[model samples]
Target: MAALISGAIDLGGTKIEARLFDHAANTQDMRRVPTPRDNFDSFLAALVGQIRWLEQVAGDPSLPVAISIAGLIDPRTGIATASNIPVSGRNLSRELGEALGRDLPLINDCMAFAYSEAHGGAGEGAATVLGLILGTGVGAGFVIRGDLPPRHAGLAVEIGHLGMPARALARHGLPIWPCGCGRDACNENYTSGTGLRRIAEWAGLSDPDPVHVAGRAATDPEAARVMEIWADLTGEMLYSAQLMLDPQVIVVGGGLSNIPGLPERLTGALKRLRLGQVSLPDIRIAAHGDSSGARGAALMAKAGKA
Candidate 1:
């Protein structure tokens, strides 16, 4: 018999990516296609096509699929509701599974990221893990002894929306910008790319992107100052999670995590607040980097974790 194959799709607003992974975490036929945001039929077709492609390449007739989405994916109902994706409030998994004749597992993107790291990535070997993304937004996924709950409704580790106290923002002299969620001064104001842009303005910057802010932090004193404030605010954010969940290891992913030396800086901030930490929990960058979503989707399919 041909080796059993596992597959996954990372569904994004702009693109849909499908990947196949062997038991060893090695990938094959990684493929990407435009997401048909306007039409649900087109979107489903894109996913099915990718699955067929991967199965053909691997010579497996029936490939199990698990998906990672940026928003809430309810495996029970197979419905998805994401802010950016147009297909909000639709039975994505159930409908897709009907088309494919199989019950597909679906997980939130953050959970997938966390599951990936927890199983074999940076968070490997840790009983409790926080898979955090410090990129366009600040969010996390919690894994308890490798169990990732599938029906989070996208709110389990949504750390970005938690507001930073006015007192905290006062220290950095940053303005209380309104969040997309209609709240003023949510954590996203200081921890997301938009937040980074706003923080950069405090250092007299204009429209600086996350990459620009991270790159200049090394050479420019003003930029360095902003990052310090960013780190402090972020530290505050992570500290709250530590107090609540007390994850054993934190694996940082996303665009901001790629900044050289940032992982160390974030580690220091978390450790400082750990309160006489007995061997501070490990904080490290994501080992699989951007591939965590797709890879984790496959893993969840193979393990039935979702």
Candidate 2:
């Protein structure tokens, strides 16, 4: 008899990853592929290739697959809008089913991260979990107790697109940058990796990558100033979540979380921003790196079938 296996796939703007989970729910085999550059056909072909590669490694045709992807997933239509990737607005689930001769489950990438946190990661057993992805762009998802089957109307949160505080920008003397959402001064315009470059450029610094800027902050006052600006921007926006939802724990994920001093910088900023009677929630880096999405996607796939 073929062994039973479940899989999770996380597709982002730059890379795509697929992971297989063992019966014990431990991650087993993993595969990765570069995201397609442009157009739909090449994108679909790349995704199909990834599935085929996973199957080959597992040597089992009966396994189930789940996907966590960037973009808005329409709860009604099951359509996804991966605007950053070529596969935007495509019925990825249907298309994948056709190619693999089986159904594949899909969930928003940030939502998957949220699910992982709520179910098994940092947010486990917490009253409320606010999940954050601070990568190419900012994304958010949330979980509350007693919501059986865990379904939101497919639009829960998107913190990155929030308008940047004009006063903060002017105080720091940074030029405005454009966001994909056709807005100037959106939070993502200054907080994302690309956004970091724009901030550095405006500050007349040669380097803009958050990792490098973080390293330079201790020795260079300019880099420290840039980091302070980011901390302020992030902490200020995070306050919105605190006031609105009052989650017990806020989990931070994505590429930037890997930076060394990030946790200290962000937590200190949070402390500085807390107002009277608004209890500050515990903020920590997401335990899982990129794999959190895949793990949560796998869980979603299991729940969807159940």
Candidate 3:
């Protein structure tokens, strides 16, 4: 008999990815589709269609399904809030499950990334892992002893929304900018890929692509200055995180993490900010890359079954 498989979906701002995987987290089949940003009906249809397609392809009609979404779901109310997706204030799991005629587990994408890393990715041997995502935005999740801590009202680690340190802002001579979350000087406004682009633009760089900006830092004085400020701001945040969580390893995943020498730069920044004689945790790139979210969602479904 074939081993049982689980279905996983990673719902992002621009796309939705679905996959079929086994207990070992190996993908059996995968599919991707553009997300319907404004139409709820289209969004539901997209997800339902993908799952049905995967089921047909795998020849398994009863596989458990799990979702990793870039948003927060209130476990108490079952309502979800995703800025980019159209499911804000709706019971996504219930509605999506009803559409498919099966219950489905949903998790935050950052948490899923963290779980995947903590289990067998970059943080395999560590007792605690901090999964930090520096994508279009910033977000983090913590995994302790192979499990995620209980979240209340979907509020676990919202470090992105925290206020940026005044010292770092003043040192960089950057203005306090408003965040998408309606707050000024939030860390996401400066530490994410979007933030990097904004910083580059503020530094008078016509090219605001984060990758280009980071790549040109060695040659362009303006780009180098922007990188320095970005690194300082990010390093300050990580310093606070190190003090609070002290995870054995910090696994960085997202678009910005792919920049070459990012970990080394961050390490240098951290070393400069060191206050005591304590050593810092290992900073490693995520092992699973883009697939970590979907794969982790599948693992969550498998764990739920056991």
Spell out the clash pairs found in candidate 2.
none
Would you estimate the TM-scores of all the predictions? 0.91, 0.89, 0.95
User: What lDDT would candidate 1 get against the real structure?
Assistant: 0.80
Which pairs, if any, clash in model 1? none
The candidate maximizing lDDT is 3
Task: State model 3's lDDT.
Answer: 0.88
lDDT of each: 0.80, 0.77, 0.88
Positional deviation of residue 38's Cα in model 1 after best superposition, in angstroms = 2.1
Residue pairs in clash, model 3: none
- Candidate 2, residue 103: the lDDT equals 76
Of candidate 1, the 10-residue stretch with the lowest lDDT total is 147-156
- lDDT score for residue 304 of model 2: 66
Q: Where's the lowest-lDDT run of ten residues in candidate 3?
A: 1-10
